[model samples]
Target chain A: MSQRSAGPELLRLIELMARLPGFGPRSARRAVLFLLKRKDQMLLPLADALRDAGEKIDRCEICGNFDTVQPCAVCQADGRDDGVICVVEDVPDLWALERGGSFRGRYHVLGGVLSAIDGIGPDDLHIGPLVGRVEAGGIREVILALNATVDGQTTAHYVADMLEGTGVEVTRLAHGVPVGGELDHLDDGTLAAALRSRRDVKR
Target chain B: MSQRSAGPELLRLIELMARLPGFGPRSARRAVLFLLKRKDQMLLPLADALRDAGEKIDRCEICGNFDTVQPCAVCQADGRDDGVICVVEDVPDLWALERGGSFRGRYHVLGGVLSAIDGIGPDDLHIGPLVGRVEAGGIREVILALNATVDGQTTAHYVADMLEGTGVEVTRLAHGVPVGGELDHLDDGTLAAALRSRRDVKR
Candidate 1:
């Protein structure tokens, strides 16, 4: 990239592709070459898809989930409980919970966590919108399905503090061993949490 | 991806992106989310770049390198030695050699090596054109700068055989320890090669 030899157009494509989460300069070059090889099959469709997605996908007005609609498909869908809300830190977290295909309650995406180092406070996130959603009435519970990182926990605690005295129970995701997780593979913190939060077998 | 919840257009974008090398479903989803967050800045420009690169970039007619021009920049560049050709296995290899900024001679991209398992043969590559180039005259040395692999060596032999009696000298890259390579970290084969091809130190 420092010594550019390829066409400017191709190099530009590599530069942008390298901005993705896992791609580096070397991998981006390989990906570009691969895409160029399958111009009609892969490159054209991908270009069209990227543009179309960018044009259509917008955040849901209610939950901040990305969709082609204002309120999102999750918010618009019937039978999902509006009384209970599962709060997440980012869009990827919301999508991750959706992948489980079990959560039937509505969702509230906070956009990001509270990071003092990053100068991200409550105002930087959608915490105020969340509190407003809670204050709108009829919400019974707010499950803080946030990550177990320091920033994530701080954000969850702050959201919980803001949502108090509203006659609604605020909760955080339980610390325990994952369903198929091995004790050997788990870290000391997870193991300790698992041991501390042990539940009795109800046979 | 199996339990799709994101917008159809966004999901389509992820699906196409996942097909790219080094991208899996999870990373693709994360990338799509990242792109959606910066619609105007990253996503749109990437989409435009993809389309533009695909439309404009083409393989060099003479060297098989990807570029906007038919003969490519390297092939058309003035003052490059036409008497010496560095034969490479693919575009990336050609690019790698060019990155050194030392190979002043012209290049001949073979497109690929002769692989029996992959059903790749000499006819599948640009060997015919290479032979034609040598037979047409003006070329002196044909450096086999192919990778140090079985298929590469086999292809080098085949090319060398083909170039015989064409009045052009066929050479290969030296097999030895790389410059600045530590002997302890080097493989046995490379160490053996380095020892076998050792040169007297100039006083």
Candidate 2:
């Protein structure tokens, strides 16, 4: 025997599965076996869902969010505050904000941050369309909801510079200790920021 | 807005993905986003592989292993010691043994071990077919390469009881410290078993 564990079809499935995020060879093998064990319930549905999403899903031309429509559901939805747009680094970040149900504004996905080491420039993101959206007017404020990394801050600074003369207020998420966060567990920078931005008690 | 983060198509995909073995809601969301970002390269190929596997893969009638063919590659392969059959708890265990390239004998996958808590019994497994193969009168030895868990050992005992009068020898995997295993980290049962099964060193 040639030491081949499974047939080509099963092997191919395992190979592709290992490439997925958060999976390696061993976990992928375990997952494939799990799928095979419940072929009708999980394997077929996941396969169909993948194909359907691939064929039907399209990026929103306006905000770069993915949906089954030309302008994504968020972009097409009514009553969303169109005057205030929140700029996120990626779709997941947009989803994260939306899940909180606090942000009632629109969103613009930048696709990625401006990473110097990765050779990603401002032009590589949706900065042009974002500027166009602001220049087209009626927008009062732009919320930069990017990550707290160095790349994210640099990208936010660059975006703020780009919209300096647009007459629209460009703001960012506040830097402070998170809700339910322990000061002892927080980093020195976060603690310092929290202390610096301390507020007075109304009572 | 209805608090919907994404469209129904993308939502369904995420729902199905969250059902995988190692993925939860957060990791599934991350993975789906990663897939959508590489729709043409990763998502499409994964979907294609899944559909192909679902349509093409078959369970081996003789040994209960999955492959593209009926009897599977392991069953049909020559030069294997047909007289000795290595019994495994599932197809993954068979694959693990095959990857080692040390087992020259054929395999018999039991689908799963007997689990009383889960209401799993001999009838739920491939034990009947295994006994039939042994009774067909060419098999000389049966190696119970099962896990060392309580359910596994109980099932092994039950199988040995069923094959009591078959005139065929029944064996089990050795209990000992594993390769690169540390003595300090070894469990009491394993240390005792290893000491009990010690053999004299050959000159």
The best candidate by DockQ is: 1
DockQ values of all predictions: 0.70, 0.65
lDDT agreement of model 1 with the native: 0.89
> What's the TM-score of chain B for every model shown?
0.95, 0.97
lDDT of 2 at B5: 62
Give per-model TM-scores: 0.96, 0.96
Cα deviation at B12, candidate 1, in Å, is 1.1
Residue-level lDDT of model 1, residues B1-203, one tens digit each, is: 33346767877888998999989888898898899999998999999999899889988888788998878888888888999999999888888888888888989989889999999988899999999989989999999999999999999999999999998999999999888989999999999988998899983
Tell me the tens digit of each residue's lDDT in model 2 across B1-203: 13366777788889988888899988898898889988999999999999999988878999988888888888989899999999999988898888888898988999899998999988999999999999998999999999999999999999899888999999999999999999899999999999999989893
Please identify model 1 stretches exceeding 4 Å from their true place: A1-4, B1-4
